[model samples]
Target: MTDPVDLFVIGGGVNGAGIARDAAGRGLSVILCEKDDLAQGTSSRSGKLVHGGLRYLEYYEFRLVREALIEREVLLNAAPHIIWPMRFVLPHSPDDRPAWLVRLGLFFYDHLGGRRKLPGTRTLDLRRDPEGAPIKDAYSKGFEYSDCWVDDARLVVLNAVDAAARGAEVLTRTACVSARRDGGLWRIEMRDGATGAMRTVTARALVNAAGPWVTDIIGRVTGTNSARNVRLVKGSHLIVQKFWDGPQAYLVQNTDKRVIFINPYEDDKALIGTTDIPYDGAPEKVVADEDEIAYLLAAVNRYFKVQLRSDDVLESFSGVRPLYDDGQGNPSAVTRDYVFDLDTGGGGEGGDGAPLLNVFGGKITTFRKLAEHALDRLGGRFPAMGNAWTSGAPLPGGDLPGADVPAFLNTLRTEYPWLPRKLAGHYTRLYGTRTREILGNAADLGDLGRQFGPLLFEAEAKFLRRTEWATCAEDVLRRRTKHALHMTKAERAAFADWFDNAAASHRREAAS
Candidate 1:
């Protein structure tokens, strides 16, 4: 019989990946299994902001707001290439929320988290300020505040990469079918989704960070019941051609008291989102309905001078938030704070029994702290585990000098003078100090192999497959990188065909 590992993590979203990395760095043996691609679930479908939930302050969730606000800077420092500061311009609507009340919320947002690098909020004159240029002339006041933006999907992949580097096994497209406690350990059975092959492992502890599938995992997979429930709230976003100018994003209030964000996306597009409706359908099947799209467009049309119709939408996506049910009837009011349920198999102090930790309700902004707290909860079981160290640690390729991205970009341009300006910028932004790994010994564009699209190259795809666990074309085009957004439909289809053939040949070679 094989010896039991220290921790077995289920799910590949931010929380699960974060926990796996944290535990592995703490010198604990760990295995993480994801039923699908990393961040294919809610992690990648987020609003993509690392702000302190300014709206949560109105609900008096001071604690959650403060923690998220502090995390903004921590994450920015850790991965300056993928995460950076952005200013949000909130157009004041006196009918929805008073200016003084909005001012009060901004004050708390600025001061609550010991904010440093990010600038504080400033009042804007809608009639004069450039930020207010897109707003209707009827609006005369606005507020611009600081927040951070993130490449959400890449964050999960980087965490998994860091975990693997620290000696944790990361199995993507693998499902944990069953977990049973045997002889004070968990006998976990997992099946590969690609191949009909099953494998088993014994673990001293189990962690359920399955996001939307949290309850399903606990009841069906682990064969255990939890009193806590996950409230599935669906939020949707629309990708349209960017209508407004400037690097700043716009936040407008709606008649229903909800707020809508029109943010810049992919350099030439806009990402407008998000409705909080109670969802009962399968989490994976969630999509933006006609009403939600109309609602978002209406909200934007009310604030901005430019009118957007349904035809303007180029793409849309949705995700289900598995919030910890706090008996809140309104989906919007549900807490984003995470809760942990520890089951010690009815064992008392110092007893010989395995532990199961089920995580519920967390956001990308607080994932690092959530992992630290989760590990701290298990400190009693693993007395020899290393102390917390991730706060100061850099993930994968984030080790730029002083976390200065522009300086690093300049250095990359100097070294790779043969690369195109746009391609160089793309590599520098996406890979940071690790761009060299993809560039390798390539002296020019011809050495980088086939060009699938404008910015999609053979070397980048090969690097993702070899190092980042990319198996399918969608994994590379959609999640690993946003190259699909740039490529035309025909171009994407051609790339997919080429990628599949290449992957099959590589697999055949390995089999021999």
Candidate 2:
């Protein structure tokens, strides 16, 4: 007999994981299935900002901007470990946008939404301020504004973890081959990628939060059609060594009016990004092209004193944004707002009344609110479910006293004095209170099992597998942690070999 559940969520991106966490917390029996690793899609490939898209304000999307702005602080307070305040330096360019106009926009940006915790915008004298020291002398004035940065991958994992803690079943490396409605419930068949094993399950409701694969899952996988279409807009980012001092990030406007973000990253690197190009290619094939790289570098070089050459690029990655097709001509002009296509269509050839909720075009900044809206769309069917609870609740270890991260860090260090300050900081930033669980009774560095690379111990890897649903080496290094960027290629290869062997042993033990 197939196992039964109240909610079955397809995809493990931020949206899917967020929905699973919300649904499970609301007393629903949930199962979340991912074809690959969690956040392996566009969720992990975002600009990593939890801010209102300042450009979206120009389109008169005040509603989206306001909601996103409010969400910035909500998310920051909810996940203080992975989310923090960032100040963006927007250098003035007389040719591109007038100072008064920029200031007007900044004025509205400051006052348009609920501004509680984050600081407001401030003007900077480029010639006098240190932020302007890196900029070309051609720029005279700028504005520094507040926003929040996010660990995009860890956000997905934390959502999944919260879901699991609330009794949701998370199945990674599992693909939903087919889903058919059987009366009032869904009969789903999932195939395990590792073992070639198949499992049948039943669900009362199905959620199509597959992001890039939304239409694919709706049409090809579920044998259903949607009136709405997902337009794929590809965005790319490049990682390089930190060339400038200070924690503040740069938001430079290009001659073409596109803005590029140069943000602080990984304690010693700078992250620069994002070109919007129409992408017809599959999401998996999305990569940062040479032209895109050149465009990004040129955008940075236009404002900064340092001429950024292509050789300075350490790594580059791209993601396909599954934007809802609104017939916008320019990919950059495409709306970042989301839409829900609920089809209560005749269920899977059997004519059962099963509804499919299709999610299209959402940003990382408003995932929690998005999940709440998704659940509300289907709330009439499940009136017995609880009311909204996410806004006030903390995400996992985010419940640090008074939400003061420094105090929590101090306490954490006091508990683990043997841990290096840098390593302890990394742990506090990544895992928060759960760092204690990973360190569990370990007295010193030697107790951490195996030393794979800088700041990556086997204990943390095992904790990721056991608690965070990490299954492979890349899942551990790139998504669950950023150890891969710090490790040498040889070290990465060795770690991959060790992880494979360890995973094999773990699977064997689980089966036995």
User: What are the models' TM-scores?
Assistant: 0.99, 0.98
Clashes of each: 0, 0
lDDT of 1 by residue, 125-190 (tens): 999999999899999999999998888999999999999999999999999999999988999999
Which parts of model 1 have CA positions greater than 4 angstroms off?
348-352
lDDT of 2 by residue, 125-208 (tens): 999999888888999899999999999999999999999999999999999999987777788999999888999998878999
Best by TM-score: 1
* Top-scoring candidate (lDDT): 1
Candidate 2: residue 293 lDDT (0-100): 98
